[model samples]
Target: MKTARAMRGAAARRSGRRGEVLAALWLMAKGYRILGFRLRTPQAEIDLLAIRGRTLAVVEVKRRTDLLTALETVSLDQRERLRRAAAAVAAQRPALAGASVRLDLMALAPGRLPMHIPDAWKGA
Candidate 1:
């Protein structure tokens, strides 16, 4: 039973990753240049890093049964972590450092179209 549950969880994570990739591609179509996926720093992991003109976007992707749950997944601590990660990424890429940074959330729930919340949170 434990093995079955683990497998299910892994499958769900993979599915969510796929959904995020699709969403990233959709953003690309809208002129967002994808910088990285699953970028990990000492502080945190950002699901997607994208750029549009002079704006740098750090995206968090959540797959849940409902939008509220997905939105809730990104807690205050997680937001701070993402902020640190974005800063680290910017430090590594000087061009991006001068760009305005924003946090974004992409939620994908079954039977519903994906929802993107730009500037989802401002780190305190």
Candidate 2:
């Protein structure tokens, strides 16, 4: 049998994957094409990479009890890491090379639609 901590970890991973799927569907509804999911580079892991028009969005999905808490889960350091990872991914793809890139947040809670915060973090 799995230990309590292992069970919790599994549940958390399941929830995170669900949130990412929801976020991707939400982005698709907004006309953004999902370029990748769980893009992992040496610098960081981006939940979702999407493009719409001339914009490239590095999306972070959060599942929490509240919007503020969900939004707060992404730290500044994480944002910078995601930005750097995104840059690397963009460099590898001709389509994303010159698009404006930004960090976005998709906050999810029970029974509520995903809240998309565009350009949520303006990395310096």
Candidate 3:
């Protein structure tokens, strides 16, 4: 039998994946093309990568009881990590080199539409 902690971890992973899917769909509806999903880089794993016009969006999907809580969950360190991951990915993809990277957050809550916050953090 799985331990309680293990079960909780599994459930959290499932919820995170579900949030990512919802975020991706929401972005698509808003005219963004998703370039990567659950993209793993040396620094961190980016939940989603999207591009529209001259901007490349690095998105972090967060699910919580409310939008405020979800928004508060991302730490400064996590933001730095996301930036690093974006940089690493950009370095490897020539097509993305010239695109301006924008860090975004997709906040999901129960019984509400996903909230997409563009330029969620200023790039370092």
Candidate 4:
């Protein structure tokens, strides 16, 4: 049997994954093509990678009670890690090479649509 904390953590992970899917769909509806999800590099795991034209978006999905809280979950250090991961991915992926990358946050709150904040964290 799993402990209560572990159960909660599992549930949270599920919710986060769901949010990510929702965010990707939302981005698609807004005309962005999702290139990857939960991409792992040595530095960090990017929740989503999207492209529109020559721009690449490194997305972070957060599920919280409200948009503000969800956005707040992406900390500065986390942003830096994401930036590093994006750079690494761009270096390895030919499609993303030389693409302009920006960090974005998709904030998911209950009973509401996901909010896509582009350039959410500027350069970590």
Clashes of each: 0, 0, 0, 0
lDDT by residue for model 4 (1-124), tens:
9999999999988988888899999999999999999999888899999999989999988887877786778788888888899998898888777899899988887788789999987654
Candidate 1 TM-score versus the reference = 0.90
TM-score for each candidate, following the candidate numbering:
0.90, 0.95, 0.93, 0.92
lDDT of 2 at 77: 84
- Reference-based lDDT, residue 41, model 2: 95
Q: Would you list the clashing residue pairs of candidate 4?
A: none
lDDT of 1 by residue, 2-113 (tens): 6988999999889978987987987888799999999989999889999999989999998888877877888998888898889889989978868888999888887887
CA lDDT of each candidate? Answer: 0.87, 0.90, 0.90, 0.88
Write model 3 residue lDDT over 1-75, tens digit each, in one string.
Answer: 999999999999999988899899999999999999999888899999999998999999998878678777888
| Whole-model lDDT, model 1 | 0.87
Query: Which residue segments of model 3 deviate by more than 4 Å?
Result: none
**In order, what is each prediction's RMSD in angstroms?**
1.9, 1.3, 1.5, 1.4
Residue 95 in model 2: lDDT: 72
After superposition, candidate 1 runs with Cα above 4 Å error = 122-124
Which parts of model 2 have CA positions greater than 4 angstroms off? none
Minimal lDDT window, size 10, model 2 = 115-124
